[model samples]
Target: MLENSNNTVLSEVDTFTNHYPRSSIKRITRYTTLEELHSLANKPLLSIGWLIICQDTAIKNSYLKFLEGLDQSNLVLFRITSEQKCSELLSALKADKVQYRIINNYKLKEEKVIDYVCKNLSITKVDAKYLCTRSGYYLPEVVKNVQTLKVLPKITKPIIRKYTEDRRSIAVYDLVNYLIGIGGKTTYEDCMQLVYEYRYGFEHLLKTTLAQITVYIKIYNLILDGELTLANCKIKKKDLQDKEISNLHDFRLYKIVESFDKISYDYLILLQLKLQQISPKFYSGVFDFVALLKINAKPGVEARVSTKINTKISSKVKEDLKTSEKRLDEFNRKRYTMTTDDCQKAFEYLKEQRDK
Candidate 1:
């Protein structure tokens, strides 16, 4: 009776083991020199196993290639076409025709895939796998070391603790003020630094690569939302200052009603009158020289000789006066006078000079 009990116990154990589904494993051998498939056939423990769960053949091929290049030990490639029956996969494994002993059971596939990963890769749970995949950054040996794997929990904590954290949302007022502050003056290097600082300070929960993309997307959206008016943006500080000064000068000039040509002519005439009034000593000296020349003329023919000498001197003076007038005209053409206030100040100074 004891021997009969032992046989029944053994049968029960066998039945339980057989009822457990087998893991589907696909062995992807990396080729060296694109020719030898078995040249580097060593396996490393992949902390996670991924079942290529995509239905698209192109996606499958691309994922297969991606996995084949990834660490070879953790990778298993399986294909499930719509036409292929599940029994065929079992038969292939039973006949030992599969390169790897893992078989894909469509009924409990998702759980089976997770189970196979945890079993073969020596990982504790499926959450680690999800974190790594969602990170979008390629980390080949993240699961190889236990210490590095701990980063996954910290990374996922933000999602669970979302309510406790003060989330940052881009406000329209903030966007407008930021644009007005830097706007066209912000260089590419400045933008890069700003993005880095923003990510490090406010977006510590997000992955670096994702944070960068998110920042860029926000900038693009701000532009699309008409928050930033770029048509008149000045990228340089000097350029902005120069434009402001130019606008002020134009405004001042615009307020003056008199035409510049008429103003210039009136200014020249006023300058000539001022010169004539202020230089009396110079005019007196010239008059004295002419009188001396007339007095020193021949005695008996004093009037006639003095007239001839005066006529000759007057002719020479006329020529000199013509040259001086030409020079004065050129000066007036090139030089500009100050505005009404400056002219009043000059008149006051000339009156003081005359009084002295």
Candidate 2:
């Protein structure tokens, strides 16, 4: 099938026909009306079926309206992102009503990029390394950079470095650790450097941060409830399996539990709040995400965490804390029956006890 790069229809079809006169191909785009789609789908096929490329600028629920009752079995729209295959789309495809199967994005490995560069450009491993570094190991970026230097009489690491802008990337885990105050003392500038070094979209980083925070919060709650005791740095295997915390490695969990007291609970709560606020503004183009992190990580925030605790606790509040912990544990065990709002309320109840 001919790849749909642009909107020019007649010329591309002509070129395809000239190459393979026996085969027939038709292109359907996002702009194609429902009526037009039906007309095209119903047309007499010289071949088995038509391969249509639907390129929608803004994917929405309304697009599904175009295919509700269509009976085009041979039409296939395969090159789509995972996000586009919503629940509604899945249901249609599952019932065999929809003919197309949307596919997830495929990422290229570093080895593939290195092999391509070495074979096509006749460059050494050293030169290929420079290209990979400069392009941040992104397939499209690397291809674009190499194409610019392919016409040159000779290619070298220095020449590639000089010609292409440096977008060398950092490890995602390293940056996440720095942002969450795991290993080292980090400044706002340090966090920003890591953020800028990431080549993928900010959405991936945001999702990763949310997931990591969830893990930390679960561990924190376990410590508060005396389930994972900090004094002994040990937990029962059955407890881990029950709470779904078994995915964490043994040594890593031990380190986190040991250092849990060192990391301020207040700061983590502040960071989680800031992350939730900025999530809606992620695509607004107005908010600075790094600035939110900077504000949350301001000096003296961690100082709010006190090592000293009140020895005397009222019986009522103590009972309430136990009740909240029980509810949270239950929610963790049977999450399908409990919403995130329920978990938040339990946390707030625990917070009130801590304050008392």
Candidate 3:
């Protein structure tokens, strides 16, 4: 009787399992849409889905109109504006269903907008990715923003290593000088390659080395800071002349001195040659210390050295040392035998002359 009852229970279980809905067991493919966005606003404590609309004026107007046509009881359109009047206008038009915000101009400047979105919105990465993919105008910037947000700091170490392993620091500095010499224009890929080639060819420096990576990071940071700019290859190549080319050496020396203070002049010169050996593109320019000095002259001797070393002035600071032997030529031609008093008087005269 126990076995019969067990069999009965098993049959009932099987019958129930057979009747279970197959559709319910199937995977549901969910997608985001305007309807789902509306439903998100209906909860007692609603969390709004922030849509960053970066479209042309006409498209923006059309979107505003579409939102106005909807049952916007739960939806609030947030319009970001630059002009104070535009914000007021937008607020007046969609008084009940929309909100207006004025974002600081600086906040929209390169990569800052991403920080803004991450800070202001309560959203998932998937949702952020989706919004970035759908937006037309600021899409790339937004994607970059999200990437910057999600990227782990430790991951940057590998890139730094690759930079150093490639001897890219030398290449990057060379490229910067080349760009400056050629009037600050070049294709992005060409500039990227200028550094990348160094990394690929040099095996002594590994991408894993901290020292090597640090150099690359320093070079890139200079570029980002507008201390260096990249230009198109065709333009730079066309602008290249013997005179402009010769100045490249002096410019490089100046940059090194600027970056690393009072480095042995011999070491600085040797590094220039080593860089040239590693990359022939470096040899295209000449070094003009005198010209550099004229361009970067300061008010006094101490100030001059201070400014040159500190400010990265591309010139020689020790011109007096260079021309020290010629100092006697500045004296008057007549020689007179003199006592200590005469010598003191002459010294005072000479001091005044030198000051002039």
Candidate 4:
């Protein structure tokens, strides 16, 4: 019964999140269930909201199977995109008392969205129309393209075509792992090829790569200190929200933790150090940082194979980690104690590390 069309589900979700600016809104896909909703309902003090966006047929089927269990008493608000499913739930077969909101009436038209972009960016109706058409009139896609366009000096039809061209087949996750030398080596050409293939801005890729590095560093430290073991490495949903852990699936989290068995800690730290060095320079020029990564960010196979010679390299990495820790600590300390120019430099360094 799950219906699909040119739904404005994403824009509605964006509006919901914007409405509850201070609420700890949890966004997920098929992970949501009646039990999970009840668990959240029990914690009213958290002031949490739930936004579940599912396009998968399997997930929709799974949801339909449990629709009878849902009642009006449930506190969660479902902004489902499917009109048929909503109608079915409201029918006599399910719960007629079930409350819901249909967003189809509020959906933005192509002309309206294009005009918004045109007025906001001070661009002509032609360029804005092109962007909206290329972006499929999706609000988030249009916003992302607008941000990318803002970085450039001038907008051109060719540039819009380049940025809006979608290559859904490319696995950017594998490219990211390769960039950090997880499964294989990476090159500047490979990096730029990914840009062209995926059509994701370099800033987006850089932030994604940095996020993976941060997660690996956190998980690696826990493993090294004997605080976490693969046998008992289960992470709860609440812990993810509490500790601000990346909202990754359990399978992906497990795979990331398991990767440490083959990848060396030293290699991860080396890649992290290189990212830290270029991060500050990113504000000056993104190409400059990319060039730096090309020159110094390549982790060699020798380091990758260190897991085989752990006894020897483990000690060296531990010693080097101590020194690296001191350097990082000093770098952080200087942010508060440093002069104006130094503070601005530190600000840019931290800004590059953040995913905005």
Candidate 5:
């Protein structure tokens, strides 16, 4: 009960509070689509707590769209993720005259990764520490691989061990596989999907890995044919800037040329050098990237291209990728009725070649 201005005591239900109490009627949740966001905006908020916004841009945009659609008198409560994101959210909220709180972005440190796995994954501290310690400083990949590991039991998977052994190699392999899977023609979103879903066995995850393997195959073939030589193909540029190259809308080519950032084919060159140190036959040449790791390869490209394979091997990889996706879809429909035969055939081939 609350006292009115006239000094009369009355229950909240006796007034407009009956429609919306002094509390949030809707619980806290993540809004997946624009529809859900609008549904909440239509409701009245009795408290300063309702929506929870995370790091995903797609979902965050929807939340901002919802808030902007409301009037200034409307009450909007939301928490935006901090740490290298939420600029769009902030701008949208500002436009709508909304207010929000900025909390830590939940960044992963070296120890934090280990702790999360140990606590949430039901694994021993020793195992979790071992996993994080080996994956090095690539925190995002470490988190994803750890989450993938958490999905299964504590036993080590080959892919998980490979990820721990070298995240850069796994990243390059996935990047190359992703590029090849699209037949050297795709958008940035597709590239992100391959990198983000590399661990969870996205049906087409290994297509570019195989394509990368095949690119090496083509390089080796060229070397044997005397058509290309690493000595002649070596790129010579002083202080190449990767940040500038990242804007180059060609996923197929720039993924190899852009060396200014963490995710680039320049890392693949480094990986190739490391592989050659272990075994000469791994690449048999001083460079990978089709022995064409130069940025000035005639500025070659056309945007939003189709699946055009430079090699005959891509068709086979594409077929295998489709089959792997089918298996994943089947598993989704019936979790117990899944088999590793198609998956093993697609991935194990790359794994065997990756190690050898």
Candidate 6:
């Protein structure tokens, strides 16, 4: 996705706005402190989704009856981890309503899941005990996904994938990193080149609209209003080619970091001009400045809530969500933006819980 070479010739732009590839240390350093980023994984650490599949008619019907037996306030949260779930699961039973709930990792324990599965699945205690001890430690969803593998395909290779999460936080951290790069007087070509190189990871972000790019725009408006200190940060190797940095994991990230606050404003004017020259694709969300930011802020793991008829959701979900807001006199449902599909799934989950 590199632009035709006519415009990206780094020399055409002044040194303030343009930058060449820097040491992996310098690039990774510009991101939030090093303890947070990662190698590629399809799941965004910030989401709480679920994966539920019951191939056995008895298990499926039992789980559905279980859903029909719940109380509304005891709703479950599912972080649907797989964006590509259609091909992976339920291809044979495509018409079956897919159920999900968002869950937090702090609350999901292996022992608890094993206990729940043992009591619910009517399987031999030995098999239940065996599954409870499976060794894949990537995410709790890995366990849930494993349950479906008898019918679903096991991943034999590493695949690049994307999904959406925590828009505001992502925007803030990413914008700061971008601002730091520009303030450092890095060339625009290098910045654009980085996004092009790691386009797969950012494919979803690039499709998000700018209005969704909230925190950064609010800060950008504030910068114009002369409120917060705007600073530039830098590091890149001018000679590295597209072919050289193809393997991102090799981008040695074990370097030091300076917090966003520490970067200086020495190159502000140059940086301002640099922002002016950025293409509209970034504005339209066709490109994401975040490819350079490198990691999701606020990492979260997915919890797969099985939505079969007899499957019972543990009371754990309500215990977390139903709390009195200290400022509010009464406990109120927390408002969250969810797609219609997610809302309907939630509505069904609530109906199951509430109708009984």
Scored by TM-score, the top model is 2
> Tens digit of lDDT per residue, candidate 5, span 1-356?
11122211222222333444554443324545556555665545454433322324444554656555655544443333332135555666577776565533243345655666567665677767666665654565556666666667663545456545443333554455433222244333334333333544432333434445545443443434544333432231111243222222234333332211212222234334433433122222212222221111213322212233445544534543544444334323442232435334534555554464
TM-score of 1: 0.14
Ranking by TM-score: 2, 4, 5, 6, 3, 1
Estimate the TM-score of every prediction: 0.14, 0.46, 0.20, 0.41, 0.32, 0.21
Query: Which of 3 and 4 is ahead in TM-score?
Result: 4
lDDT for 94 (candidate 5): 76
Give candidate 1 misplaced runs (Cα > 4 Å): 1-356
**TM-score, model 4 to reference:** 0.41
- Worst 10-residue lDDT window for candidate 4 reads 1-10
- lDDT preference between candidates 1 and 3, better one: 3
lDDT of 3 by residue, 76-146 (tens): 32322223234334555666555544333312332333344445345444443334332321534444433
Candidate 2, residues 231-290: lDDT per residue as tens digits?
554545334653435655566667667656555454555556656656533334113355
- For model 2, which pairs clash? none
When 1 and 2 are scored with TM-score, the better candidate is 2
Whole-model lDDT, model 5: 0.41
lDDT of 5 at 47: 49
Question: Candidate 2: lDDT of 147?
Answer: 83
In order of lDDT, best first, we have 2, 4, 5, 3, 1, 6
Give model 5's clash tally.
4
Indicate whether candidate 3 or candidate 6 has the larger lDDT: 3
